[model samples]
Target: MAFSADELRVLRRALAVALHPAPLHDEDVQDALLLAASVDEAVREAGRLRAFLLADLARYREALPGSLSGYLELLRDALAAGYDPQADDLAALRALRRNPAASELLARCRILAERSVRARLARVSQATATSAPTGPRARLFALPGGRAADDEPKPNPPAPAERPVPKPSEVFPPRRRPVPPPPPEERAAG
Candidate 1:
């Protein structure tokens, strides 16, 4: 899975072709397909490696409140493999806070955890903000006359007086139909 620089270059080129479709020569197409297969294999290998690292991390974690050095090393390896540190990791680090060997690593882990949290929050907030309604709008499909994209003429919302409130019964009427009994012969068979 570990590609040499030459392989990396080839992989990148193949990826470029895949991402940006253009008429490729037969040889180029074949090369890209081969590279794609290699990439898939590499991905599988990375996943296996990650799983092994996570297992190692768990072993170290369970041996914790001791073996700070090994735990920290495994923790770093897990992090490198895209493992998110959990509450248990934080708790363990906190317990090891007094260990001089653990102080720097503890601080580093705390920072990494915080940074990850902030990043996740920011991503969520960005998504929410983007999706949230920004006032009533019948956004123009085609450009409006003499209006820039920013000056989009939005449709006005219905006034409170204009908005009709439905009665509960009207909104959700009770079901009228009852379940019919099974045929006599069918019921007898059952």
Candidate 2:
């Protein structure tokens, strides 16, 4: 298998956490480990089939020694399983002495497989790079302009207000204060 024991263990742990999530789990968590093991076993078996078929196609070369279509089918399977038929894989294919038709088919398969691997890897790498965070500290810097750190929003400032001037009547209306007349005895003396 291409994966080491530790890799499979990590894969299992990840699967288990995804299946039955818990907060306080360590590297050797139980349920996740079991699920990971099961997944690893399945993947290993599938890989074996893919590798065997790819190897056979690379070793055989005949116009119809074993059906050009059949060889192409094997290559498709390998590609689907994430195999990259690059220089090494092509070298293996070149070693085969199949007929012209089979050779052509194998060549096409190799090209397609290589393309698929490259495209998928590119997508995966792009996703990883985009999601990778630089650091928490970088978020503290001030943005663009030299505005104050806590400046209030200025998108829409208060509109110019129009104060109504008071009319003379409104400013000084007649008062109803009581007026005191001269004393009654003074009036009688007069």
On TM-score, the leading prediction is 1
Give the alpha carbon lDDT tens digit for every residue of 93-165 in model 1.
8888888757776787788889899999999999999999898986667655555755876777868758578
Q: Against the true structure, what is every candidate's RMSD?
A: 14.2, 26.8
Identify the candidate with maximal lDDT.
1
- lDDT against the true structure, per candidate, is 0.81, 0.66
lDDT of 2 by residue, 58-104 (tens): 75424334454675566666666666666654654565536565477
- Give the TM-score of each candidate: 0.61, 0.33
Error of 1 at 121 (Å): 0.7
**Model 1 bad stretches (over 4 Å):** 1-22, 137-190
Weakest ten-residue segment in model 2 by summed lDDT? 59-68
